[model samples]
Target chain A: MDRYAPPGAGSAAGAERPQAEVRVPEIPGLPAGIPDGGDAPARHEGGEGDAAAPEAELTPPSAGDRPAQGKSPFQALTVIGQIEGHVSLPSQNKTTRYEHVLPQLIAIEQDPEVQGLIVLLNTVGGDVEAGLAIAEMIRSMSKPTVSVVLGGGHSIGVPIAVAVDRSFIVSTATMTIHPIRLSGMVIGIPQTYEYLDKMQDRVVHFVVANSRISQERYRELMFRTGELARDVGTILVGRDAVREGLIHEVGGMAQALASLRAMVRQGGRHQR
Target chain B: MLYSIIPPEVVLRPADGPAAVLWEEVEASGARRLILRRDADGRVVIERIISTEPRDYLDPALQPGQPYHPGRRE
Candidate 1:
């Protein structure tokens, strides 16, 4: 079995194919038609299965304090550790590869069984291009998407937190906004500075467009001085992020799920 | 989000050592901890985490008037 194929790991590429048929495990509370859990549904003729299906029919799939394998209405996608792009990071480092995530996002967008999505993010961030690319794919998805910044969504992670349809930040979560900095030896010429400025503009524009914050305020935060002892930027914690308009609400998993359920119930996201 | 239910009556005192109770979920796939005790009759007692403290990890919104476990839907 693939190391990543542990039960409830969510849809992962099978050991057979790199990105072959993406099979999502049955997160009990999710709606039907959602990716089947590889195993065929148990056919209980006229008793337990029938009773279970009907009871779940009236209500949306939620943890509901039920033992897992509870039906769920959406898939949970987590983005933890550094976002590893084209160049692989060291083996010891905890990384979320864009190559892996890119394929998964495509599969999720294509799968009709999967309804809405809840993206959980906790990253120190990495490659700007790869992170932005994933953010764009999520933003362009047809299904509703909600993001919750569980820990610190810093660096390139800022754009991702705002890329979804709706956003949430827990009371303890923090986000850092700073000017993009390139690593490795640089030419340090006028042209090099110009190139860097252009790239930073791309991130600035994306952040402003997707979130409630304006270009002026965002830039102010990005270039703010005297905040970090070694770096320049502003750190917005929890409600601060919401007040700044970067996140839609100051909430944890409960509020985020409640909002998503309302969106699904409103028919914007058709549930089976 | 896997929880090993240990009843309150069971005397379990953080076996092995103190663990930082953050982001650590006892996955069904064997990421877990066990609490065990040998009784006078040589019977071993096991206490599992039926519910976790700072239950915020389970559902950030699970609050007020609701029991930790769901009502029997059946």
Candidate 2:
């Protein structure tokens, strides 16, 4: 009879029982062996599959392996939608809260690894004080900074666009220069107009100090009539802003990043 | 005072309904606080990581919209 025959088939069944009992543990050991051996091949198949899709493979695994591995020296801060101030705007309105941005700016400034900042402004503009507060913070930072205005940087966005060391406006971008006006409650006293005028002056002064635009010309643009259908303001688009001396150049992301990099290189040399 | 071209009436309009999702701050491992909310599937998802350290922002697990597994260590 074959030694490996089934337990019930052979005359030696009783004698083979001890051998079969010893082999029973090997049945469970097969599954354990698959995990040890199968895991490597499964991983190899996965690695091969990942190699087929290079772009997808690159970001996720690298991001997972080392989150801070490819940290860029330059950080971008996007100021979009409306700038929300002290009072929280209704949830419906898309607003950039100053509280969130202010701390990030501080963190960017304090981080030694961060070499420069790029402010991307695409705002319709909101709260006067909040906008000015953010603009002032950007202006005060010692590190090299650049601003790029894409789409529209209207109203209070003007000061922020100019607050950086250099500014660029995409060819299709537009900026509206307008006098500040109160919307909600007005006391109707002469003091109300005086108070608003003073607020306007703060914006005007900040822009004039930061950019090449003169106060007289800026006021001219602010109070210009017949341009806006209902309001008295001048809309400066692309090269018009540069020609008027409100923006440094008529360009987009490439120019903005290039200028910022050059500025950072120069700043590094000076520090050394 | 607002300086935008958008009208005040449009800017200050009230939302139609109560907010659907509310984010609550939860303390996680490594002294990190995460703003999180449960999704439609009832899975806890991170909304934002509030940490003073800039390096904390780079953590892939702590990214916004990432699933927050309660017992996972940093």
TM-score of each: 0.58, 0.72
Model 2, B1-74: lDDT tens digits are 77888987677654443344433444443223455544455454667665434466777777887765543433
What C-alpha lDDT do the candidate models reach, one value each? 0.55, 0.68
Model 1 alpha-carbon miss at residue A17, Å: 29
Model 2 per-residue lDDT tens digits across residues A159-186: 9999998899999999999888866675
Which prediction has the highest DockQ against the true structure?
Answer: 2
Q: How good is the docking of model 1, by CAPRI class? A: incorrect
TM-score of chain A of 2: 0.73
**Candidate 2 backbone collisions, by pair:** none
* Cα shift from native, residue A76, model 1 (Å): 1.1
Query: Taking the candidates in order, what DockQ does each have?
Result: 0.04, 0.12
| Residues A1-272 of candidate 1: C-alpha lDDT, one tens digit per residue | 00112112221111222232132222232223222222232210101111111122213334454444332357666777667665433222345556546655665666666567788888877667888888898888887888999878887788889988889999899998887665334666889788778878888898899988999999998889998766778899999999999999988888877877888778574221
